[model samples]
Target: MAAAEVSHKDLETGPPTGSEKHTNGVGSKVKAHRTKDAQHGDKDLLQNVFIGAIDAGTTSSRFLILDGAGTPVAQHQIELDQSYPRPGWHEHDPQQLIDSVRECMEKATADFTSKGHDVSDIRAIGITNQRETTLVWDTETGEPLHPAIAWPDTRTQALVRELKEREGADELRELCGLPLSTYPSAVKLVWLLRNVDAVREAYEAGRLSFGTVDTWLLYHLNGGLEEKSNVTDATNASRTMFMNLHTLEYDDKLLDFFNLDRNKLRLPKIVPSSSPDAFGKVSEGSLRGVRITGCLGDQSAAMVGQKAFTPGSAKNTYGTGCFLLYNVGEEPVISKHGLLATVAYHFGRDKKPVYALEGSIAVAGSGVKFLMNNLGFVEQSHEITDLAATVEDNGGCVFVTAFSGLFAPYWIDDAKGTIFGITQHTTQGHIARATLEATCFQTKAILDAMAKDSGQPLAELAVDGGMSASDLCMQTQADIINIPVVRPAMRETTSLGAAFAAGFAVGIWKEFHELESINQKGRTVFEPDISEKKSAKMFKKWSKAVEMCRGWSDEDEDDASDQE
Candidate 1:
């Protein structure tokens, strides 16, 4: 729980076998020859290759040092101080974002060295961050012009409505692979230009620099204005609604549509997710001079971490919010469904960019957090699983978790969080079960949409993040989706993905096949237990609840307008 605490638990769930031999920076099949005096065995040889990953998430900044086997050697995490000045407005201090990362790196590096490992062995570092969080800074001074507008912030809701009616709005999605919504950085940047005086003035003066969290962190981590390592990967740039999905570059048409001048505003260069030289080195820290080789948006990194490289492979991350991404292969699929299309990851400059169809649920683990902190249903978040298990089923209850409106296929903005079928027979267990089922139902819906868009059914769902730790929840998910839910023993796949990217760029692993055994040990597979008829009945009831919950938020808005 402490920020500087170091976890020493063995992350590998099973004992190493004879086949799990060490590789000396070559592919997995080629074994490293051991010297006669090698005392630590494979682990000592593994110490020769380690990759560092900096995970800048929604609520925390973490640094993880992982071995060649994808096991974390040392790590440190620090919770971020989030500011919600008004409802639907989330902001983070730009300085604190990089500061927390630097501190985490220092602390994690200290832990790594204290364990008798050489810090110089950290061959390359990678960065994975929360995507679409917009930041602007002065090009001359390298100081943030305003607070970082987080991805979840809905401050541009009214602006989104106006933009949707604009002439070129309909064509925007086909070009950028994103709908005109409050989620993208383009709208956020437009809002700042219109409202924030400092940002507007800087933009007008041609001294403004715009970047997502990745670029901001890279700039500071690589020695700020002096080094000027202001660049973002294709995965992050794809979310900005400014980059062309096919070209992987900033589009002039998109800039014109958003009314942004390329001459006036300095945007970060779009680079491959895994490159040996694109991301610069850590300027001054415990791992100073180490090359930062790989970078990805968190979800993309998680996909790589899960090794979901093949087409039709899908991953569902149930964090504060749920994100379901289905790999559609090299070409980007412009979603006919309510899902968003985006780049999955691009390994190198020459490698063709892989794309995915994304479906975002506004509430997942946050719904569980509401149960623990708001409703006092349990003392801890994980206890909600225990409470739900007290009931065999939801007892005819269905919860529509639309706390800040639903996303993905439904796109129901006028619906609030609603629960239905509450009878005298319903108990806390029933509600708890329904709460867990809400995420599962949404995931099933997203997968259905993805199947429609890509013409490929998801064979198994690779899951991670906080909510995936619950066996009851994962089992429910498996039952509802009628597919196997695969969970790796090492759930820190986001960090591992970044490390893998860095490792790949530096030739620690030569090919994708070489990473097959890295984090595959002791994985759990939850099989579908319920009958298809039973699953269909439950899903139908959930659909009815979703329809019933519509217009609740709109009604509240109308009532407020009447009062005014």
Candidate 2:
């Protein structure tokens, strides 16, 4: 944990002075953006400069202030409520998200402001968020008509079922590179219209507008209460099932499929994921006047955070769930595997887009949440890592954390979470190790599918997110995949990724080479030390456990299936 606590200030790229150069992956030419208390006499060496980034995630929202090169100087974070109104229902107060954003910004900027940091030093803010969570509200008043429906909510299962029965169901996946799951916004929109009275009336009156969390926050953050500034990045727009992947605009077929009127519904202007005119300036609060310069779906930002821009570079984020993305460059490849084609980022309306092939696991960190809260295996999330480290191995146990069904590669939505290979000899340590192993197994499967679809064999995987802090889990990941697991010196990669996008877009920084030079900060590379034979043996056992977990409890399947 001490090793993980080190910051990556040493690796940040230099400010954009024109030449796009990088050395060993860190930016050079130290320049002060945010004041670092001039305690450094001539003898003290200068390092990174400061920038701001905000990351909106599923479980919480955080604000980070990074220096010129890409290391977090100070951060503020808050966890919001997760509402489960009923079985398979998940929601967040849209207003809560808005309030949380304001609060977090205040906290992160408090230190800078207190020290009398120059406002000019803070160039812009980059925004990254949980993709596909739906937000809809009145256009004029900026009031959410209903709670924001989260991506994990399966209340839209019936809606997804109906869509599948529609004529174009089969082609939706090929067209959108996404299956007709309850996760996307299209079905959620349908459910909201049917079930929520306010949504129905708003839609009928043509006063309703919808967007992902990024759009919602940006709308409010950019003076929505006073003026209209609502817009969404292309990456967020693509997940809505309404946008044409190639055209980067709303499609007629999708509108017809979801029974949505483009004009009636407020759609954010599609902007480049990185751009100057694309994002709005925060109108109020401590971050007031700070240009909102960058936006991307959280997963894409995670890939960027890992600096996986190079082809054949891959990353998997261990969060409430897990997502693996392989950077496929400018073109979006329609996935042959059960994965999705996504825009990594469009440098904000001007720069050509970066694309990725993504596969997700619906239940990664949430599985630990279950053991800690539901099953009482541990006291807190951090303790899970320590408990797992207690065991030399899983002791012939395996767990398929399918609490909410499997995602990516498998797409086994009907399956529930399961523990496999449990015997009388099994101990708590085995279960703890199995839980961690579960994350790695699902990650490997997703990466394999990603590789198959994108035609890129990853040489290494750069990982981040909450769970990536676990050394044991990272080592397991490296050993299982037979590739080096590179953990960045800075763990707050999400916020840094957002800052990078915003800074680059505004010319605070220029090319990837320039960003690369800011700093390489040190990295912990976990190599595959296990023999191939041993690796194969564990995988075989893990595979069998996965099969056993499938088709467990037909009654529950029937119940969940009947709801659809």
| Number of the top lDDT candidate | 1
The whole-model C-alpha lDDT of candidate 2 against the native structure comes to 0.73
Where does candidate 2 have its weakest 10-residue lDDT segment?
1-10
In model 1, residue pairs whose N, Cα or C atoms come closer than 3 Å (at least 3 residues apart or on different chains), thus clashing, are none
- For model 2, residues 1-564, the per-residue Cα lDDT tens digits are 001111222112222222222121111111111112212222211123456877788778778887775656678878878898776677899988888878988888987766667556788889888888998898767788888888877665555656789998887765666788877888888788877788878888888988998999888888886768778888888888888777788888888888888777877888888887667798987777888888878887777777777766777777777888888888788888788887777774346777778887777677767778787988777677666756667878888887656767786665667777788988877898898788898777777787777666688888776677666677678888887777665667667778878887777666675555333445556667678789878888877777776765343333333222
TM-score of 2: 0.88
RMSD of each: 7.8, 8.0
Distance from true location, Cα of 343 in model 1, Å: 0.8
All candidates' TM-scores?
0.90, 0.88
Q: Name the top TM-score candidate.
A: 1
lDDT of 1: 0.82
Task: Report lDDT (Cα) of residue 344, candidate 2.
Answer: 75
| After superposition, candidate 1 runs with Cα above 4 Å error | 1-47, 554-564
